[model samples]
Target: MADSSPSLDPVELGAYFDLIEVTSLLRHAVEQQLREAGELSYVQFQLLARLGDAPSGSHRMTDLADGVVYSRSGLTYQAGLLEKAGLVIRTPSPDDERSTTVTITEAGRERLAAVLPGHIEVVKGLLFEPLSRDDVTALAGLLAPVREHMRATPPRSAAPRRRGKVS
Candidate 1:
């Protein structure tokens, strides 16, 4: 007789798939709406939002990159585009000549304010309205461990490689 058994992977069985799907769907919906608003990419909107929350309407480029998951070069490129559009400005950092600071322009603030209502509606439609109060609480609880793990683990550094020399 042969044994029949089932295999279970708890991590896989848990929230990963649902989280990924929900995140992707929400992002897509929000991006679509923001794109239609005519001046901001979703990323640009997020950048502006971050600057709006900063103490002086500005942030160090490195800090902004970390907040938005962009690399330094990536943020530079995005900031350049935003500068050209009059939505943001890059200024020399007083504390560090090597680093630049980004500030949201008045135009950017106005643009974000204009689209925020629609964005919030889309977010509610896609992510929130469908969920009951209990579902939201359950999701928050379920995600806490994943969020904590991500925060606790430092990003991996590249390992040194052995050099090959002619014998």
Candidate 2:
């Protein structure tokens, strides 16, 4: 029997490989810059950046885990480390009894501020340098729908955890 799986044509295959390589390169550079500038791991920086950007300066931990595409337990551990560093505060959510909220503290903002310049430089050099304004716009236009399609399903973190063996 023939294998029954969809396959990419050469153009699509090349595009997929190029996208993966570029993202990996960009992430590595960004991680290095974040570590050097603020002593933050990539996930910690993402959490702080999200909190800092929120108008209310906070979000429920579940929302954070989904937004960052990180596992819930991993997010919890990272939040705990930030709490110990006095960079963020975790509190019981006023709006949701079962949910915990995380807020970026002043120190978190300072740390984010300290890292923004280097982060921007790294991103610019690695990701945006070769792209023209039109290329950047086209890239976003192309990827936005794909991103939306992927996000149409609930994030993995939003799924209920299985407790028993499957049949």
How big is the RMSD of model 2? 1.5
Worst 10 residues of 1 by lDDT: 153-162
lDDT of 2 by residue, 1-167 (tens): 99789999999999999999999989998999999999999999999999999998899999999999999899999999999999999999998888999999999999999999999999988888999999999999999999999999988866889889988
The CA lDDT of each predicted structure is 0.83, 0.94
Native-referenced Cα lDDT, model 2? 0.94
lDDT of 1 by residue, 1-167 (tens): 77578654887766668778989999998888898885678888889989988879999887887778766667788889889999889989999997898999899888888889999999888887999989989878988997787757542222233478859
Best by lDDT: 2
Worst 10 residues of 2 by lDDT: 154-163
